[model samples]
Target: MTGEPILEVRGLCVDYGLGEQAVRAVTDATLTLHRGEVLGLAGESGSGKSTLAYALTRLLRAPGVITGGEVRFHGRDGSLDLLDADAAALRRVRWSRISVVFQSAMHALNPVARIDAQLTDALRAHRPELSAAQRTERAAELLRMVGISADRLRSHPHELSGGMRQRVMIAMALALDPEIVIMDEPTTALDVVTQREILTELMRLKDELGFAVVFITHDLSLLVELADTIAIMYAGRLVERGPARALFERPLHPYTAGLLDSFPPLHGARVRMEGIPGSPPALTALPPGCAFHPRCPSARERCRVDQPPTAAPAPAPAAATAAPAAADGERTAACWLIDADRETPARPARTPGSTP
Candidate 1:
């Protein structure tokens, strides 16, 4: 069930200032998106999930810059490195080949524009060959795809509910049927039921349309349910990534484990929720060795002086169960605590008031 590689990222770094004072918001972040696959990125508020998405799509403004990286989009037209592409080059690749449903999607919609206009505008711009009738017809189809009625096409943003507004944004993103869709917290403000509905609708559309999705959110639990693969980011770096189930069942990184623990169980029994202790370090003055050492419960002396690269697949011991084999992308993490053969200490229970 592996889809073809639609997007590949390597050493993606993004900074927010000039040299000597630059704060690296996305450091050496790497991952892949296969066609029709859902890749979920989960992390803290500032772990750079949105930044990575913006950088990949070349949406970052002046203060944010892509310091280094390669973002290649493989298409029938052939592969193109988005990072190296000029404005015109990127313009051609974006939207038509890839589209983004930004965070707070409702806010992204034009307040004054009608739903039909907002959704069909991209089509008018990208597919000028289509006449007004064709654009309007296509817009209605897009709306229907997201479970919205064509009758609401003339409605304004203020008339729609939060969920419907988000749906309009999704429909607009699919206006051109792009190969890849990067969704940044598309369901952040919705209620649990709405979130589930929106996610379910998105998955159905993805299946019907055959588009790869890179869904970014802080909720690991949500990702586990929707994403085929999950990548955990930390302190501006991708600390761990693996199959969604694998990462959930036996997370390799302490941060990943803490993130999972932080989630309140939806069913079974109610328990006290303990989030990861200590705030993430400022990128300008990150810890010398591993950025996570200060907060990692299983961190050792080795983790204090030397940084660990995202490791290759580790051999599983006979008695211990290993993390599931990755479907396609890299299955690695930057934690020293996890080794398939070596006995790593179990993560310590959470402690309140723990600080850096």
Candidate 2:
């Protein structure tokens, strides 16, 4: 089980440029991650999930800038604000306290360098006291930890399979035993079998090492199986967040429900599934009030003019026989349809999809 807040983000905002040409990519996003927990961030392609992860780690590029909000890292020593941290402090925190496994392993890894060299580079930089032999031994051990044979240490990126390359990236991230691992679709382009193998290995490693994870992906089904808590993003705003089962079985937000319906169930009777109608609004020309109102099936007159604040969802009906309900204050959704005075639209019963 997870325990204690290790990371906290509040009102985080990110923009692509400056002045009149600036385009907001992320707005007023807030979430907390606990030690040994897996917090899944799920959204469509351009929903700013990657941007949020980059901003949290201070890895965003020049075109993208963090305009507001704070990220606090609670360490064994003390709490430090990531946004206000200086270069020296950030260096100390990055690999030692937090690490990242980027989206594309082939792009992230050096095509020309041997796997051993790539793995040991961080150790050499962070732990200069260790001798060359000691670093080599550590690198070999990292490979074995990720289920790769130590003999493959001499192999270059082009020599290994796609799955192996991704595993190497995971090994490198864990080189310093960081407390948090931010994975931005680490399993994106791999085959189904390979994805399952990697995910199983990752879960095992997380259990053994006790590291928290911020898993960002567009695969909601995969996250429903892997995540302890799931946060839904739409048009750069957090629309809903709750326990994985709770969110899957009873999503309070229309966008969350639409996402669940987009995937087909693995078992039982076959049924038609409809994708969310209409495209996401452009950040440069977003609709007024709620950004999702244009496509929301449950949209009301009030929803078109007033933005809904994130608040606790109303209790489920007694007849609902799904996952256990989250405790009060533990579940939140940003939709006017979930308001106490309003009647929530009845969701048609449908089977949930299984992980591919």
List lDDT for all candidates, in order.
Answer: 0.84, 0.89
Instruction: Please tell me which predicted candidate would have the highest lDDT against the true structure.
Output: 2
Q: Write one digit per residue (lDDT tens) for candidate 2, span 175-229.
A: 9999999999999999999999999999999999999999999989889889999
Per-residue lDDT of model 1, residues 207-260, tens digit only: 888999999999887887788889998889999888877666667788888888
Model 1: weakest 10-residue lDDT segment is: 347-356
Q: Which ranges of candidate 2 are over 4 A from the true structure?
A: 327-329, 340-353
Clashing pairs in 1: none
RMSD of each: 4.4, 1.8
Give the Cα error of residue 61 in candidate 1, in Å. Answer: 1.0
